[model samples]
Target: MNSSAGRDFRVVAVQPQWHAQDFTSAGRFRAWMRSQLELARPHIAGDRPTLVVLTELNGLPLVLRGAGWATRLGTFRRAATALFVVRLPRTLPLLLRERVSPIRALQLADADTNAELYLRTCQALAREYGVYLCCGSAPLPRYYRQGRRVRRVPGVLTNQTVILAPDGHLIGATNKVHLTPDEQTGGVDLTPGDLNDMHVYPTPVGDLGVAISLDAFREDVLGHLGAQGCTVLLQPDANGAPWTSLEGLPPDPAQLRDQPLAWLDSSWKATTGGRVRYAVNPMVVGNLLDMTFDGQSAITGAAHEGQPQSYALTGPRGGFLALMPWVETGPPEQLRETGRQLAAGSGHPHENLYRTGVLSADLHLPPSRVTPPTPTAHEEALAALLNGEGEWPRPTRSGRPAAWLALLGLIASLTWARRRRDGDRGRACAPGQRPR
Candidate 1:
């Protein structure tokens, strides 16, 4: 790896499909990994680029998706059959399997447990891969409140982002501040930290800022990256439906109003010259039906006033790899001139008072950070609701007709049971005489 930096470099972003069970066994996953490295290895060996970035969950999800049971037999059948082919029995113990074996409680679901296993597996994969891999976040254990000043005991859960470099070295990581609603209060009942925060990993190439899905949606988050000297931003996301080619589809004329990309263009024009690399690698949902990932991976980079460049690879509805070159852009700076030019401009007729140029709002300001304020319990709860957390509300106890009918039915059933018992007692007493 190139430990020092200079110009004339290349970068490969690997977008591997990670949904189904094809990548479960050490052999299958390692094969996929080898293929990805083979495709991009030349660049690294040739010293074209010193870094290789991989998407999150490149191994574990494939295994979990493939695990299953045999019909009529009590024993669970491994979903992936390719395990023995690749010598995985020897490797399974090395895997991160905390979630698969945790003490099951009523509050924890299979999904939560699997997520934990996924995290453990990721750590193991990073150690073995020996590349700069941005393993995404998994939840960690935190204190949860049951209700009314009662606190549940703390234990580890799955949550948080992880990054590993080549040779299995850990870099920096950031926990997601803005979780999807289900991840917030109630469902998993997690407490969210402040927003507008980021973790900057200073690599040999340059500083990289990593964020989760919703974190990218905030303008403040973007600002935080720009101000902190981050030249590239990486997002490991599982967002909307995975897309195939947009070919043969007609543009919607009614929806032809200006969109955000256009605004982005204008913003770039107004701003000082600086380059920002934004990459989004979302898990492709379509290819998972057969318990497999459709490595429909894509990457997009936006340069100031330049055509947005993107690279993608979608294939055989399973795991595939894509490697693309990326040019690193530095932060902005002011213009300078020689002494002779300065002297010449001092007496120039056009340089009388003010400089003649188009005024740009973006150029006038300094960059800032995006950090959200700490939230109160009530506010957090409401935010959780917005994020799709909380229990389903029950029917109100107000005396509406339905409520009254339910109440009446319940009372009638209780009264009838009591009367039946009393009648039996009365019959016995009448036959015997006044009972002692």
Candidate 2:
């Protein structure tokens, strides 16, 4: 464990109310972000190093400026799908032609200008705030070196999360490895990165790890981070109602309830085993086109006696900062035992507050052991499947041939039975049934 494990740190999770007009100019978006920082300033009182987390795809608005389709369709879901469908034929050729060429496909979408502006704004904000900042996730085309030349595969993009240091220098970045079906159909066509390649950023308070939106729902991702001895887990999300569907169907109503929070709590405990001292989830709020985001940003940790506690923002909009005390982790054996008990369905001993509006809290962080857990073969296989490296075991194909043979036999038997019945009926009717 790092010597600074016992040091306290303050973190501000900003849940901003986004507007379409803000994307008209980079300055407008910066101004909106600055306002959110200002709102969080009062709550962030401490000399300790602080980290500010923004929501997933918070930079999307800036990247989508001047999109003609956005103006006409007036909804992100519809606009994105329509744009992709309209240009699909043309897009396929470019994708196939440039499949091996080192060229960014952003020009086809006309998003280069906005992408540059969005990145610049994030760097500026990190420098201005002088805090470790998670600049949120953005769908950007990235180039990598192949042999001696730098190249990008066309028509492929990664939803990347950038981490900036206090001095505005790039520290770490990771791409969202899990893409929802809606995102895939909406022209996002994101390339998933390996979870093992995830960066663990060293911070003053603890080692921090990031899981963007849907990635957070995967237990393997969280477990891998915990095994790496990450003390803080940052999850940036943009959860909303009216989920985008390829079939134009409405979302399940149960999804809009408090079920997400329950899932978050359960997943955290199951993966981290109280090893990660702090878990912060910041979600985006407000309406973007027709989608309305639900902002229930939260900070959760275990209490002194191994009970979980959480401070959440239940409102639809706003910001919250939590000043958390650093507590040294317990032994590895104890953490494993705690995890086992939790897995046995022992409920939480304490209640958490579902807070609304602006809120602040000074909570104690649970102690965790930094010993990296050695995964078994089964665990490794599961991780590989989740990371898309290995395919899930399908039922044996050997049964297929047998099934087909059985079907053929049944068909032949039925044919013979029909023929015999017809022959018998004809003979009886022709020879004797006429006399009766």
Candidate 3:
């Protein structure tokens, strides 16, 4: 929330610390979040419009808080199973009422509890701080709110990104429209968000946009939101890869020496198109069960896109407003040296990676574009397809078993996290940075 006399707006990016202990109790989670928000209070007291942002999946681990005895389990699957056993009384009613698979019922039960905790905690904090807040993405099914009650809309869970106003009311929400191979095929089975209905929300500073993780890389989703006159883009992230890996990067003569920053294109390059003036990428860092999320959070400007990029891809001319220190250094290959070797090389406990970064900067923002907020061509086409303007393709008999296979694969994988190799999922967006 830092501001200067002539600045048009301000951004406070909270690169949050994620750990099971924080969400073990309602008081702990709220207190942890409140302290995080307190870091923004210094920047928010002025007339300048300020927006506070958290990283993607910032609230996803809240599930561990509500799921009974989950924090005590050694791995995710074990915790989930323990959760079912611990909450059998509540879950039995859901099973009888919905008659869905045990897995599906578990997801619904999860959505029923954790989503509210995430929303209420964020809403209350936004109001207390009196600042606009983007609470990152949470995994929840489609839900409707009716006078303090949240009801499920009978859909698979989606990575839902929500923006809250200074008064603490929800401004708008968007879901992840692109699914990684793991998200779709993984047992989690997240639902991809539709593009046609996506739109920008009005903020005091300008129109705000939400593109959680891979959705920021999507042409359709970005096109639709850009069409709606979005000025600032929020690409909240929790990359499950090492921050410095250079896997799968497209060659830029400029990037061959340092390919890590190439992945910033998901947001930075997208802004050079002129519609988005600024992009805020706040990332979560820490271990969730055996999974890890690491990254250096940043706020970059489009006007500086023409400037020579820094290794961090930031500066005043269209570079970074602020960039956090990276967790690892040196070449991606050296860093990727065998898993055991890599693990042994680092004496610092992974818990040492849980540094909470609070970055605030005053930005001289542009006037919002005068274009009418309208659906982009991609959105229209998608709407048409969904409206039955085109035929709905039926799944083949061969495709029928895919769900069961994905579920089995997910269960098998989740059953033993120690055996799961570390690659870049968070880094997958970065190209070959994800390990093979």
Q: Which ten residues in a row have the lowest lDDT in candidate 1?
A: 356-365
Model 3, 1-436: lDDT tens per residue? 2223323778888887677788777888888788778877876747777899887766666656744467666666577555644544444344446654444445566665566567778888888888888888877666543333334566467777877777765567778888664455333446788876577866665578888877776777788888778778898887765444444422322233222364565666676556577788888776667555566677777645434444332332355667676644455455443221322124444443444677776666545443434643322332233233433222112232445544543453344233223332332344223311
Q: lDDT values of the candidates?
A: 0.36, 0.51, 0.61
- Sorted by lDDT, highest first, which candidate order results? 3, 2, 1
- Clashes found in each candidate (C-alpha, N, C closer than 3 A): 22, 2, 16
TM values, all candidates: 0.45, 0.62, 0.74
Expressed as tens digits, the lDDT of each residue in 71-183 for candidate 2 is: 45666534543443343333333433555111122223433344456656777777777777787777754543333333334555667777767776666677787766434
Q: Could you give the candidate ranking by TM-score, starting with the highest?
A: 3, 2, 1
RMSD of each: 24.3, 19.5, 9.1
State the lDDT of candidate 1 residue by residue for 44-120, as single tens digits.
52433244555433432332334332111221112222221122322122121222211111112223333334434
Give me the candidate number with maximum TM-score.
3
Whole-structure CA lDDT of model 1: 0.36
Query: Over the full model, what C-alpha lDDT does candidate 3 score relative to the true structure?
Result: 0.61
Clash tally for model 2: 2
